[model samples]
Target: MPLTDLRQYIEGLRSLGEIQEIDVPVSLDLELGAITRRCYENGAPAPLFKAFSDHPSGFRILGAPAGTSRQPGLYLSRVALSLGLPPNSSGLEIAEAMAASLDLPPVPPVVVDDAPCFENTTTGDDVDLTRLPVPLLHHGDGGRYLNTWGCIVARTPDGSWTNWSIARMMLVDSRRMSGIVAAEQHVGMVAQAWADIGKPMPFALALGVEPAIPFVCGMPLPAHVNESDRLGAFLGRAIETVRCRSVDLEAPASAEILIEGYLHLDEKVAEGPMGEFAGYVPVEPSMRRPVYRVTAMSHRNNAILPVVVAGEPVEENHTAWGIPTSAQILHDLRASGIPVTASWIPLEAALHWLVVTVPRDWRRRTGIEDSAALCQRIGKEVFTTKAGAVIPKVIVLNDDVDPTNTRELVWAFATRCHPLMGHATFEHIPAAPLLAYLRTSEKVASATGKVVYNCLPPDEWGEALPIRASFRHGYPPEIVDRVKRRWHEYGFH
Candidate 1:
């Protein structure tokens, strides 16, 4: 059955021994963020903090709702479970599942009169953002962030399209907050349209909705596509949504908390210096950005707020954004006639590097002997694609290296690829400013480029290649199979 709500998804995690309930009091300041960050780095089970030092009893915080799991056969458990796949499924399997939905007819969301999220409502003078247990995730962060894992629902001025996306927002006052909306993203584009019309864009921030909802919000779908429809396709059914109390936008019916507001064109405030998913804090100081003023607030009783401590590998950013983006790239490449068998973004690379693997048969079929030319072609196509805007590095590997396996990718790079001869640079490509390698000047420079590292042997090297000395490749197949079948006889666990 489809897990349509956050509460249901949390129960699913509990059933798998993937969640922990913390009765001890935790501070929403830096303490909550510290514990969550450590848990992510350790691959620990999701934690539910039931007690907060300053917050009321009717609210709770869930940290790392879909972080990596350490259990055997469940490395991508949280992600797999979100996509309605087995917990033991691989990254590629999860990505493919999400991608498959793109081909199916979109199941439009059904609007309802009521939702659990609207059970308790606050407006005007009664609204208090400080009552919520917003966490200061990193030491150098500017303020308590309330929207790290939240999805903002907004629509164009003409109401022709609606967009649901994840953007971080920081606490500014009891009823106001500031967030960054990149000009290139869909949400940003919609916000710009409203600005052009000289009005505040109506929006609703939906926190802790169904697991699948956030994944789609983070996905880079084509512009003007309704995220609700894609979300419905992901769940294999129509998603239930409720119109916002103060805005025209619709939010996931099961959201834990809904902050209805308007993003004003004239109002702006200094926003961020928070630790981003890139695993680094921006060197640039905070700047004035569009402010979101709360008009109405609603949430279920004892609402559970989800917080993602994004940094380094195996966090929500990697599992949610990295994996899905790789699948999107694969889909894009194949649609463009590139013979890419598989693609992956190593979590350790912080979502900046994308690896595309070419099938061995592709070379024979296409009669492509010039590895450099093929690399350039793939690089140009990828760099110009929407996925390429965020990914700064692309590695094209032969079938010998599995893109999903980081170790194999590294080996292929070290042994098969020549330093200068194998790498090609693609210039005049757009890249995310969050990349640490980019200087403040290069951050805005259009001339900044990306490198496509070719980790395949020259085509002239022929079909006969060096034999691997590993256990699976070095030994005889029959002997290896017999040893595998008699592991208990060999006294091994």
Candidate 2:
């Protein structure tokens, strides 16, 4: 059966020995975030905080549900299961499934009168933001955040297309939350359109919704494609949604917490200095961000609000958004007739660097100048478009290596790539503001331009050339199988 809620997914993780419960009281002020970040950096199990000083009865917090693991491929395995695929599904399998589902017709959402999320409602004077144990995630964080892992739902002014996305929001007061909504993201674009028409943007922030919802939210779906429908397509079933009490938007029926709000065009407030995915805090004070007015709040009894501490590697930024976005880019490239064999968004790069491997046959057929130039073209195509803005660097590799393996990638760079010979550069291509180099470097021409570091040497392009053999592929298959079959007999544990 498909996993429908966060609790079920947590149970699965527990069964795999990938989760742990902490009975000790953990403060929301920096302590919880610090512990979670340490756990992620060390490839430790997920943490469940059973006690919070201010949280309502039955409410709890879960951090890093899908994170880096010491066990090989476990990170991507958890992500695959979150998307309703088998836990052991390969990256290629996940990419193909996502691409294939694009052509499948969407299953319309089912409307329901009531849901578990609406068991309690707080609005008007009764609502108090401080009552929830929202974490001050980082040491330098400006305030408590309640929407790090939550999904926001917004529709265009015409109400034709609804966009779902993940954006960080901090609780500013009892009735207000603030956060940056970049003009490039779908949510920001839709909000811009609404603001242009002098209308308040209706929105619903759903916490602990179905796992598939947030994954679909992070995807770069085509304009006019409803993300709710995409969620349905991904899960191979209809998503049940209920209308928000104070907003026109619909949120997941299984959501643990829902905040109905309206975003006015005129209101803006400072909203950052929080720990980011790039592993650094901005030097400047927080910039003015859009202000949201909460009209109603509803949640299930003992609702668990999932927190995503965005910092260096192994956080949700890498496992949840980075890996899947890379897979979708590969899918998009292949659909557009560009042959892509595999793709990886490395954890160390903080999801900004994307490395792709394509079949050598396709390279030969295209007669590309070199892998670097090919990478530049691919980067421009992706970054100049809607999907590419979030990516800054692209590395192209031959299919002989696996992009996901950092060791194999490093080896390819060390032996095959010539620094000056393999480099390719592009100008005036759009890029996200989160890149540290772009933000701090005086040499950067503009946010949109980028440079590609091609690690392969030019001499290795010939099809007839024999390259150095590696242990994985160079071993004789029969011998390898014989060793595997006799491992127990040989007394190997």
Candidate RMSDs in Å, in order, are 1.5, 2.4
How many clashing residue pairs are found in candidate 2? 6
| lDDT, model 2, position 251 | 83
Q: Give per-residue CA lDDT, model 1, range 1-493, as digits (tens).
A: 7788888888999999889899999988889988998888887889999998867788989999879888888778899888788989998888777777788888999998999987899998899998888888888888789998888999998988989998889999999999877787787898899999888889999998988888888887889899889878878788888988778888888799999989885888998888888887777789788899999999898999999977767788888888878878888887877788787888778888888888756667556677787788788877786667788888887766667777877878788778877677977677777776887777766336888888777777765557788877778999889989999998999
C-alpha lDDT values of all predictions? 0.84, 0.78
In candidate 2, list every pair of residues with a backbone clash: 58-302, 382-388, 383-388, 417-455, 429-448, 430-448
Q: What is the lDDT for 160 in model 1?
A: 88
Deviation in Å, model 1, residue 307 alpha carbon = 0.3
Please report the TM-score between candidate 1 and the true structure: 0.97
